[model samples]
Target: MYRAGGTVTGERDAQPGVSRVRRLGTHLPPVARAPGEARAFVADALRSWHVPEDKACDIVLAASELVTNAFEHGSGGIALRMRFTGDCLLLEVRDSDPGDPVLHRPGPRSVRGRGLALIQALSSAWGHRRGGDGKWVWAEFQLA
Candidate 1:
């Protein structure tokens, strides 16, 4: 079973206008069902935070894409984290692999390579970075 943790706090961001941040996280096994598990985890978190259904759906989709990429291409372990501050929600997925996620533009007939593209379309901003024992691919959504 996976372990989940969270904290609701009134914190301030270093940026000029962000405040009242909340955080949630979970660790998942690298398996075929990781994407579905990620979706559930994110859905629960968003629900607990009282996020709107439409926004929650978008975040869940982004989380699923990130988790699927990690399961398919990464090694070691997988972890997901989310942060909500003011009008922004951030989703991050970390895996043992250090390779960066590539955004591909596939042709109409292509069956694959569209996960990152979908994430890009759904998220306000998205990127990846090396951290700890692996790398984290993150997507941000505007809540306001």
Candidate 2:
């Protein structure tokens, strides 16, 4: 993880395509305030990076949705990680739940079931990875 004001040039043994990387992260409490805190964290990081306002808004929204889902469906501590690759911004939320997120087609009148939909629509790419103890949901936005 890159420290504040530190730079990351990708890890050793990283793919040749990965040139630059910057990362920010925070551990979120398993409470109602997690989502809002996650959003604020993303906003601050993007602002420090000088990301454009429109793009930052989308990234912040994605972070919020991911964190909210983590708390709503997952277990244990929630952690938010944001990384700036050379060409994209990657956001990931990790939780103790081992199950993958479900994507549902909600009815028009439905008030929920749209967080993943919004992430899919706004992000350049999105996916999840499962580990022994938990899983991480992630999305990427183009930096350009």
Candidate 3:
């Protein structure tokens, strides 16, 4: 006997019903503006994805880190995207940077770096990806 555990019940029989929407949302834009733009973008996206307003802070934090990393360390052009995976929201920021990102070693006096550490602490999971082109850094947190 397993419980449903925060899952939205769908149709059990042959009737068509609204299943949980594992919706995917993507955003890409020129970062020629300000810092708050990233926060605004993520907030609007979370609202669209039915994420409660109260939980916006955590999502915003994760989104900020991803976007900041892309803009700070990655290439010139950037894109921000997100999706719903199970009960969590996955956020991604892609760039054309050729540099591979690595998590800074955690130490008591560490101050020069810790972004990845922060993500790992606050988010459910996060990492980066490189393909034939460039790379993308991402993070995920519970949608609730």
lDDT per model, in order? 0.83, 0.80, 0.64
* Best model number under lDDT: 1
Candidate 2, residues 66-139, lDDT tens digits: the string is 98999988768788877786568889889888888887789999999999999999999999999669999999
| TM-scores of all predicted structures | 0.84, 0.83, 0.68
> Ten-residue segment with the worst summed lDDT in candidate 3?
1-10
Q: What's the distance in Å from true for residue 9, model 3?
A: 28
Q: Please, what are the lDDT tens digits per residue for candidate 1 over residues 17-115? A: 744337767778888888988887788778867799999999999999999999999886688888887489999999888877889999999999999
User: How far off is residue 33 in model 3, in Å?
Assistant: 3.7
Native-to-model Cα distance after best TM-score fit, residue 16 in candidate 1, in Å: 24
In candidate 3, what are the lDDT values of residues 66-92, reduced to their tens digit? 666766775565666666654787777
Error of 1 at 42 (Å): 0.4
> Model 1's lDDT to the true fold?
0.83
lDDT of 3 at 95: 74
